[model samples]
Target chain A: MAAEHADSGFNIFPMDQFVIRPLFGNHGMTWYTPTNQALWMGIAIVAVVLLLVIGTRGRALVPSRTQSIAEVFYGFTYKMIEDINGKAGLKYFPVIMTLFTFVVFANILGLLPYSFTVTSQAAVTVFLALAVFLSVTIIGLVKNGPGFLKVFWISSAPLPLRPILAIIEVISYFVRPVSHSIRLMGNMMAGHAVIMVFAGFAGALGIFAVFPVVAIMAVYGLEVIVAFIQAYVFAILTVIYMNDALHPGGH
Target chain B: MASEQLMAGAGQIGEHAEGMPQLDFANYPNQWFWLVVTLLVLYVVISRIALPRIASVLAERQGAIARDIEQAETLKRQAVEAEEAYKKALADARAEAGRIVAEAKADIQKELDIATEAAEAEIAAKSNESELRIAEIRKGALDSIEAVARDTAGEIVKAIMPVAADQKAIDAAVTAKLKG
Candidate 1:
């Protein structure tokens, strides 16, 4: 990244923004100390509340602008939950909805000029992915009892290879959270960092900054799509995991 | 700003990536603390406030649309029913009018028959009276002609035979000639 910026002599500090710092001032680290991550995450929650709760306060049959937007998002998530996991899956809709709303808002707010992306940290995303993973596993175990293990035992495979495949399935199942967390964190961080690098270039390029600015706009557009897509992917994957727990299948 | 930071050491690239802050385990505790706090808040807001509100709005709209459609269907049904009633009434009225017209035609025919019978009777009575009056006139004219014949015969006899003929004979002869 620096080699490309050599002509402009611009050294971008894109990753520095991800650092969790004390919200009050430069102070020694403590768990109780409110950090920038907390501040932004709090803002993300407020943003969601504003969009959904306050936005649809009227509950008009003929929806207003904010009401329509809220209703559209609500209907989308509702349909997604109903279709992906079935009506029985709606029992866990609140958790899934909370996660989706958080991720979406975090990504969108992160795109704002100089706003911190809460989801960009592995610390945040990993916790969310782990929560989903643990919940689905527990639910599967609780609901299916010993039958939950049937998901790993592939009866269709040859007896000799069945155990090997089961081992692979267990490993892959455990690896889900790692991939889930990393995917969102990496995507969010990469998009923002790339934009920051381009913006850094535009800073030193003087009148010729139009090219980098255009690239930034294009990447920004792509990142917007990525943000929504990542949220959808995370939520849908959660539904799939729940489905597995609800009905453990083999091969 | 990065160049000044880079002057500190060649290995330290800049504040940008001089240290991978995302992997900084020291900051993880505080980040996790906030993550949990904010997540709780978001969950409360979404499940308690946002989700229900938005769900209700969507449901309300759906219900309104369904009600409107049902109302329109009912109205359509009513219109169809009204049209059926109108058609039935029109058919009934047409049948009644046809019956009335038939009855009126029968009544007019009866009145015409009665008037024709009365007029025919009056004409027949008047004809009978006129026939009687003609017979009487004919009888009167015959009597006058007989009287004149008798008188003329008597005079001719008196003049030719120089004697008066018998009255009874003259009358009988006139009567016979007239009958022949």
Candidate 2:
């Protein structure tokens, strides 16, 4: 198991599990080859279906535990979008729920043993962030026309500082996706790596491995909370960004 | 052989440490494909089923609440109206009772006045009849006394001077005395 990592001092290859390997024998990965990443992604999807869809199939007047959970999750995302975007903003509630559940499921499933952290990977987050950024830009332009530019134009500032502020605003607007993607990916990757580092120490310490083991348990519990928070933060930010699209020009 | 195996392993790790696994382009299409598929599935399921059901339930609850409030308002108004009707009926009944009492008092007062007048006339008629009866009794008593006195005088005369002499004279004397 330590064969993959070169020993500067320790042979703990934390990054090895993140590698994309073919599900079949040692064959080359064609586009169709089901990699570990794809398998986990599918599993996350199935988990979402079972938990949300089938669990709430009863649609009872008085909800069971599973149904209540599904409805609560639904209402949480719905109210979040409504509060940030207003009534007009709630039109896009389905999209927001989809995005939230995607990140939420991806983050949670990735925490399992021998599982790939789909959201911790840059490619996945970048794709989602870019999609948000692009679609927001397009939708704002389409709906508000040239008035969409008014979001960057701060009218409350002194007239002389408007253009300078607009430039800063524009820069910040572009910087959104970079920060958005990096924050989630970085948090996930960092938490998992820290756990791995502890794992490596646990093996090396032998007798006092119990300390690291205990630490791992504590961190793992925290990661479960972090997983939910990151998803929530990502969803809230999406709503806030979408608000700019819905109300392009205001104080 | 072990050294050779170690060299092979080192080479493999070196190839992996060349860059991050995610940055590898070969895995991109497959990940992208599944991402698209899963997102579509989630979107369809959430949009078509779960959210709609919750929304309908919420709307139904809101409607029920509104209906219940409207019903309560209607009942309250009806109760107020019913109380008003009750009060009005009570006042009417009281007024009717007052009229009834007034009619009865008038009728009773008229009957009492008539009875008092009848009783006073009867007492006056009885007093007049009793005064006439006393005068008649006094006259009868005077006649009876006169008759007794005359008879007694005649009886005395017969016994002493023999005969029915001076009957008329005796009666004249008695009558004169009694009259005086």
Candidate 3:
């Protein structure tokens, strides 16, 4: 028992779980190294394939269970995009669906013991957010030309305050990806860390360890819900941002 | 021991900051590459294969249901038309039956009227023949009585005066007496 250590081994390395390491022999990490992140991501990809691709192979009018699960995800993503962005935004449906399924699968798979959470990393989330941001900006530019700048102009505001509001709008516009990415990463990382911290208490508590174990169970359940919600939030935010790109003059 | 070595390795990797591995910038490229590859695969599977297949299945189902409903409606209309034809045939048959029955009744009535008239005429002729035969029988009976009376009177006169009576006078007396 690690509890035999001096001062009752209270070594609770919550962040250690987030540490990236090579999946095979520990070698220096390069750009193309196969890491645990890649393994779990691969697993997430397999999950998506099993659910969306092979699951719907039946193509039944009356769907089977796995097919229904795939349809639920599809319907949920479709409704989210259509509700926020309307018909024009459906062109970007694939991107949003990918984002949703990736985040959801990654987050949920992270809940497994000893499994690495891919979405918890700032690098991955930041890239996703930046992808949405850059694409939406380019789409706005291409679609609206100079008219896309009107998103920040706030024509409804009084003339004198319009410039200040525009400045704020522009800053917030750039800040969107930062908030978007951090929100998902922070939620995943924080929940998992909290569960780890709680599990760490079981070592020293002995008989009272039941409390921490129970708390871990409770937090694990909450994390499961948080995992789905964070993905939904990410996908919906992407749709909303895309709506701004599609109809920049509306805001 | 593994935890310690893992911590040591992690620590060695980030000599300056052991706080959060997420901030470690060296691993960013590895994460980015795999993520992009995975997303590309998912996007291809979803947009290219899954979504369109589901949409077509749903559309096919919709079309099938519409076609079934239309077929049912057509069948129902045909049934209605058949029923109408049946009813019209029944009504026409009933009317034809009624016409036949009326014609038969008229024919029977004319036959009955002709029979009744022939019976009445035969009865009238039979009654006239019977009256003529009764008048002839009465005349024969009157002649027989007159002859008998004349013979009896002549027999009485011969017994009293031995005189013979005339037949013509007897007959004239008898006829005058019968008339009175």
Candidate 3 lDDT tens digits, B1-180: 644544454444432224788877766777899888888888898889888876776677789889999999999999999999999999999999999999999999999999999999999999999999999999999888877776776666657766546656656766777678
The runs of at least 3 residues in candidate 1 whose Cα sits more than 4 Å from the true structure, single-residue gaps closed, are A1-8, A154-168, B1-16, B113-180
Error of 1 at A150 (Å): 2.4
lDDT tens digits by residue: candidate 3, A2-87: 24433556767688788888877655666788888999999998999898889989988788999889888888888888888888
Report iRMS values in order: 4.7, 4.6, 4.0
Candidates 2 and 3, the one with greater lDDT: 3
Give the distance in Å from residue B10's predicted Cα in candidate 1 to where it truly belongs: 20
Top-TM-score structure, candidate number: 1
Clashes of 2: 0
Each candidate's TM vs. the true structure?
0.77, 0.73, 0.74
Q: What docking class should model 2 receive? A: acceptable
TM-score: the better of candidates 1 and 3:
1
lDDT of 2 at B89: 100
TM-score of predicted model 2?
Answer: 0.73
In DockQ terms, which candidate is top? 1
Error of 1 at B95 (Å): 1.2
Each candidate: how many clashes? 1, 0, 0
Window of ten residues with lowest summed lDDT in model 2 chain B: B5-14
True contacts kept of 1: 0.73
Write down the lDDT that model 2 would get.
0.83
